[model samples]
Target: MREVSSDCRVAWFLGLAGLIPFVAGGVIAWWGSSAWQVTAVYGFSYYSAVILSFLGGVHWGSALQVPRPDNRRRLFIAMVPSLIAWPALLFNVVTGLWVLLAGFILIGGYDLSRDGREGFPAWYFKLRGLLTGVVVAFHLIVLLRLGG
Candidate 1:
């Protein structure tokens, strides 16, 4: 495999750091007292939604790199994450988390489909895949903790 560049390595570091809250939230929900658990779950879900929208913004950055930007396609895709995330905030925790998980998975699928081969760097895509898997797993654990 090709070595990741310095910039990409930094991004990978920060991206993994971002997962702290996601994992912490799930752990908190699983282990905390009732009151603390509620706070952690809400905060986790909220933050997850925020990050979802940020992923959409990454696509915007990608779109900017295009010579003759396809504003319709690129911009439309960029808006999708925020749209999916907003409603997740309104529902109950278990349901909201399910929505967030779906959004993450959908966005991950879009990223891989759109640029996995030619557009995005191999290292970047691999990092994204790794992050997405962990995020989804945390959400699932959170959901099961809440529901079961």
Candidate 2:
């Protein structure tokens, strides 16, 4: 395992805090007034899409470490998440949020795959999984509560 630095731990903490909006948004969407629900749902959906695309950029940075042919492939793969995310925002509330949920799960799994084959740190994958799981759960809460 690679030695995790203070900066990495800080990033993880910040990432964990990042989940608050999702959970809060979901809760507000589920229980708040009509206006607030609309705001929460749309806000959550937009942020989720943005964060999903951001994660793809993170992978793009990682791809630069890889050599030649493999790096080319990795770079291509890195762009896929952003592409998926951007179009999701064009979709309706439920469909778009579902897409975001899937993106997080899919990318978390991709990160785990990188851990196995591309030397992504195991600790990092674990962190990714935890964050992704929370995000998915919160998304599910909003989805189910809204009957979507």
- Residues 1-148 of candidate 1: C-alpha lDDT, one tens digit per residue: 9766899989999999999999999999999999999999999999999999999988877777663435558768888999989998998877888888999999898887844223567788888999999999999999889873
Candidate 2 wrongly placed segments (more than 4 Å): 1-4, 66-68, 114-117
In order, candidate lDDTs are 0.86, 0.82
Task: Let me know the TM-score candidate 1 reaches against the reference structure.
Answer: 0.91
Q: lDDT for model 1, on a 0 to 1 scale? A: 0.86
In terms of lDDT, the best-performing candidate is: 1
TM-score for every candidate vs. truth?
A: 0.91, 0.89
Q: Candidate 1: misplaced stretches above 4 Å?
A: 1-3, 68-71, 115-118
Model 1 lDDT-worst window of ten: 113-122
Lowest summed-lDDT stretch of 10 residues in model 2?
Answer: 114-123
Cα error, candidate 2, residue 41 (Å): 0.2
Q: What tens-digit string does per-residue lDDT give for candidate 2 at 1-148?
A: 9677997799899889888889889889988999999999989988898889988887788777655557777788788788888889999888988888888888877777744247465567667788888889999998997788
